[model samples]
Target: MDYQPDGQTPYQNTHSQNMALASLILGTLALLTCGCIYFAVVCASLGIIFALLSKGGSLTMNTSGKIGLVLSSLGLAFTLLLYIGLFLYVLKTYGGFDGFMQESLNFYGVDSIEELYQMMGVPY
Candidate 1:
């Protein structure tokens, strides 16, 4: 029942596990840097990619790598949800930057801030 070549079983490479661990760390960093929208999104994306790749690397069996993959996936999901929620809240509150700017301009009866300044003839 022993399936070993030359009476020595090959050891599993630890690189995949290390990659998964790194993915988890990056995911955690992304979650913490939620305020920086772009950075958080990018980090979360990379984390998810690394986790998936690690998971796909082997299916024979792995404990540490599996754990790292799971953690990284969860972290990625959490960060993605947080980013989506933040985006929705911003959209609902202000419509968007363009809408908010247009509203401001309409309120002042000006096409833009520049027009307002021109109307006032204030040297800038």
Candidate 2:
């Protein structure tokens, strides 16, 4: 039984594939820039968005999109965990956030907050 349909064919566009490709690229970038909190977060967020969009229409997603989602999630998780650990360590070691900041400035050889401000050429 051969059932041939009518003559109207749907428009074939590569937009979904492009989204998958973009997701992959952003996910890769998120991993690459893991040391930078801002870049890592931004790239991972964008990658996840693109991946979801690529997976929006159907039950299955392209391999690249799946990989992108995984990598992006891993990057975001690693970055968040790292920062949280560092924050907790700093909080434990120092009396408070302000103390930690002051200690950091002192470690950098700035005698006081005013000196740091002066070094940065901020009129205070």
Candidate 3:
């Protein structure tokens, strides 16, 4: 048992504080920027790394570190799924923005975007 000079048990923080803080910061950034695909994944990965390191090679983990780990994992998964879904949607919409615009114009019976612009008398 651990006791302090005042005859009361004092709680000592033995967890890896630096790693926990890093994990939390990265996890938060990842969660906030989930739309950024590669960037979010990278941040979440770094957060997960720091969180695991905070465990200090033991079965026990600090509360903050565990929270950081969970947040990082969730952010990573969410961002990855978001990226993949957006990628597939882009593919379905067309190869690129130009193609998407062209397809939309075609659907409206317009032969080309240039012709539509010409009809509107808008300078290209």
* 59-124 per-residue lDDT for model 2 (tens digits): 788898999999898888888988998899988999779989888898879988899889989999
Report model 3's TM-score to 2 decimal places: 0.64
lDDT of 2 at 65: 91
- How high is the lDDT of residue 36 in model 3? 83
User: What TM-score goes with each of the models?
Assistant: 0.55, 0.79, 0.64
Model 1 Cα lDDT, one tens digit per residue, 33-79: 76676776677677767766665545542454455455546656666
Count of clashing residue pairs in every prediction: 0, 0, 0
Model 2 segments more than 4 A misplaced: 1-15, 108-111, 119-122
- Model 1 lDDT, full chain set: 0.67
Best-fitting candidate, scored by lDDT: 2
lDDT of 3 by residue, 1-124 (tens): 4457787777554568899999999998889998888888999999999998998756798877888898899899999898788878887779876777878898867888788889779999
lDDT of each: 0.67, 0.86, 0.85
At residue 105, give the lDDT of candidate 2.
97
Instruction: State model 3's lDDT.
Output: 0.85
